[model samples]
Target: MIIKSPFTELANARQTPPSLVSEYDSCVDLIGCTSGQDGAHQAPGSQLAAKPHCMLALPGARNALTNAALAAYERYQMGQPDPRQLIDVLRFNVFYAFAHNAKVLGFNDDWLKYEAISPFGAPQPSPPSQPIAASCPANMKPTVLQMTVEHHPWIDFLPCPRMRDNFLRQVRDKGEDAVDEDGLCVDIVDAASARDPESVCLVTWGKPWVLSEWEVTEPFMKKWAWLLEGCTELMESTNTWRRKRGLHDIHFVH
Candidate 1:
C-alpha cells in the first residue's frame, strides 16, 4: 500500500528545524558506526576492516555478525556443528548475514530464505500460508482497497472508528488539492498519536508489527530520509493524475 503524508508541504518547504536536523545527522552517524565506521568493528586479530568510504555499503553488518557469532555459540553448546570448525562458522555467518540484511532492508523473510540464503545452505522450510491476526481486536470495520500491482489482497483494520473518521475528516478539510486518489493523506503526527503516545504499528500484507517512536524515526534519521520525500512526491503525482479521472481516494494504514 502507498504510504501518504499530509506534511508533504512542510517537507517540501525545506525548512527543517535546526535541532531536528542535527539530531538526524547524529542518528546517521550512529548507523554508520553499526555499519563498521569509526573503527567500530576493530577487534584483536579481526580480519574484517571496513573501508572508510564504504561505511554504509553493508548496513546492519555489525549486528548480523554478532547474531551469526551467537548462533555459532549456540550450535557449539548443543554439540552440533562446532564453531571450532571454520566451515561451520562460515556457513552460519553467511546465512545470518543474509537474514539480517533482508530484515534491515524490509524484504520478505521468505524471499531472503528461498531466493537469497538457500543457495548457500540446506533447503529451507516452505513459507507459511496462514494469515496473521492483529494482537488487539479490530475496533473499526476493515477497509479494503485495490492494489495497483498484482499481489495478495489485504484489508486495513484500525483499532477504532474515531481514528478512521479523523483521517476522512482531514481529507475533507484539506479538499481536492490535498486529497490523493492514489491513497489517503495522513499527518505523521496524527498517525503516531493514534497508535500510542510513543509507538505506532506498521502493517504489511495484513501482518501487523508495532514499533516504538524511536524505531519509526530511526530509518528517516539515517541514510534513507530522502526516501520519504520521494514517496510524498510519488503519491502526490499519482493522485493528481487519478483525480483527473474522477476516481475516489484510496486508504492505506502506515
Candidate 2:
C-alpha cells in the first residue's frame, strides 16, 4: 500500500486535518480508566471521578491531530501516569492518523519518526529519474517519491474488467505546498520527483512484492484495490503527475 502522492506533513504553521474519526464514544469512565474500571466503582462514583487518567479527547474546532494530542495530554493530567514515552506516542499516532480519527496521539523519540519518512512497506517499481525539489536533507533514509495513483477520468472513459460499487481513492489536488502530520505546510514537490519506488516496496509474507497483492480479508484492502484498479484501468483514464510526495498506507512492523 504505497501512496505516490500521499498528504505531506505540516512542518510549519497552519495545517489541514487528516481525515480521521474517533474509535470510541467521546467520553471516559472517570471512576475507573487506569488501574482498571472496577477500582473506580469500589471507591464510589464521586471519589473515583477525582482520580486522574480519565479524560476525553476533544479537539473542539481545532484540527484532528491537535485535538487528539490535547485530549491525550488531558487524560494524562487526570491521573494517567507518565509513560515517559511521548515520542513513542507521537510516532504511534502517525501510524493511525491517516485512516482513523483519534483525540489522542502517542509520541516517540526516534529520529526516524520525525524525519518525514514514509511508512515501512512499498512495492518495487520504476523509480522516477527526474530531478525534483528538496524535501529531506542530503542524507535521509526514505525520500517520498513523486509517482502516485489518483482518481482519474479514465474510470468512466475506459471499460473496467471489474466494476466496484465501493472503492477507495486518494486524491492529491495540490502537491508542492502540502500539509504534514502536525498540520504545517512544506515544499515536498522536488524531493518527490526524485523518488525511487524500489526503496519503498511492500512486503508480503517474507518477500517484497513489486505491487501490492489484493487482500481478500480487510475492507480497507478492498477500497485500496478500487484505488489501484481505477488507476490501472486499461483505457479511458488519463495520467497525471504529483508535485510533492509523502508516505501513505504502507506501514507496520514485519
Candidate 3:
C-alpha cells in the first residue's frame, strides 16, 4: 500500500498561525498522528524498533543544528545503528552543522553512508528530478535535488573536518583582520526557506519500543507539533515545485 505523506501539501498554502493550536491539533490528527504517537496506528509496543534497517531524520535547529543532529546520535545510543540517509524535509535557519554532529566522537566516517555529494567538496551527482520511491528496490537510497544541494552547505564545512580546520587555519594565516576586520560571519542555511514554513524540519521514525522507552513532556509535544507542521509545508512545496517543473512528486512510505 502506498503511504500518503502528511506533509506533502503545505508548501503552497499560508502557514498556520502559531496561535492556532486547535487547528494544529486537528491537522496532526488528519496526518495519522495523535498527541503522543509517532504514527496514527502505532501502538505502545510495536515492532518498528526491531527492524535491522532503520530510517532516521533530524530537523535542523535554529539556535543549533548541532544539537538537532545529536537527535540521531541519541537514537544510536538507544541501540539503532546510524541511519543510512539523512533527509531535510524543511528549510533550516542555520548551517547544516548537524552534519558535524553526526560525525561526533567515533562516528567520523559515518557521513560516507549517504548517497548525496558531500558538502566537503566531493563530486556531486545529478540532482534527483524524479520521484524517489520510499520502498526498497526503488527506495534503497533517498533522493537528492539541485535545490537540496544548493541549499545545504554543511558538506563544505560541517562534515569535512579539514574544511573547517582549513578555515580556521586561513583565519590565523590571514590574521584576525581576515574575519574580525572583514566582518565576515560563516553562516550556512540549507534549501528550506523562511518564507516556506518552519525554520527547520528535523524528525525520525522509531519502533514502538524506542518510542515507549522515550520520555515525552508537554513542552516537547507542543514543539513537536510545530515542527511537524514545518515538515509538511516543506514537503508540499518541494513536490509542488517538482510537479510544476514536470518532475515526479516525492512521497514517503512506511
Best by TM-score: 1
Shift of residue 236 alpha carbon in model 2, Å: 20
Instruction: Supply the TM-score for candidate 1.
Output: 0.22
Candidate 3 lDDT trough over 10 residues, lowest sum:
25-34
Question: Which candidate number would show the highest lDDT if scored against the true structure?
Answer: 3
**Estimated TM-score per prediction?**
0.22, 0.18, 0.21
Q: Order of all candidates by TM-score, from best down to worst?
A: 1, 3, 2
Q: After superposition, how far is residue 247 of candidate 2 from its true place, in Å?
A: 31
Report every candidate's CA lDDT.
0.25, 0.21, 0.27
Report the C-alpha lDDT of model 1 over 156-184, residue by residue, as the tens digit. 22222233333334334544233221111
Clashing pairs in 1: none
2 versus 3: better lDDT goes to = 3
Choose 2 or 3, whichever is better by TM-score. 3
Over the stretch 85-189, how does candidate 3's per-residue lDDT look in tens digits? 122222221222243233321124333332333333334444233333333221112223222322222333232222233333433454423322111121123
Clashes in predicted model 3: 12
Q: Give the per-residue Cα lDDT of candidate 3 at 180.
A: 25
Candidate 3 Cα lDDT to native: 0.27
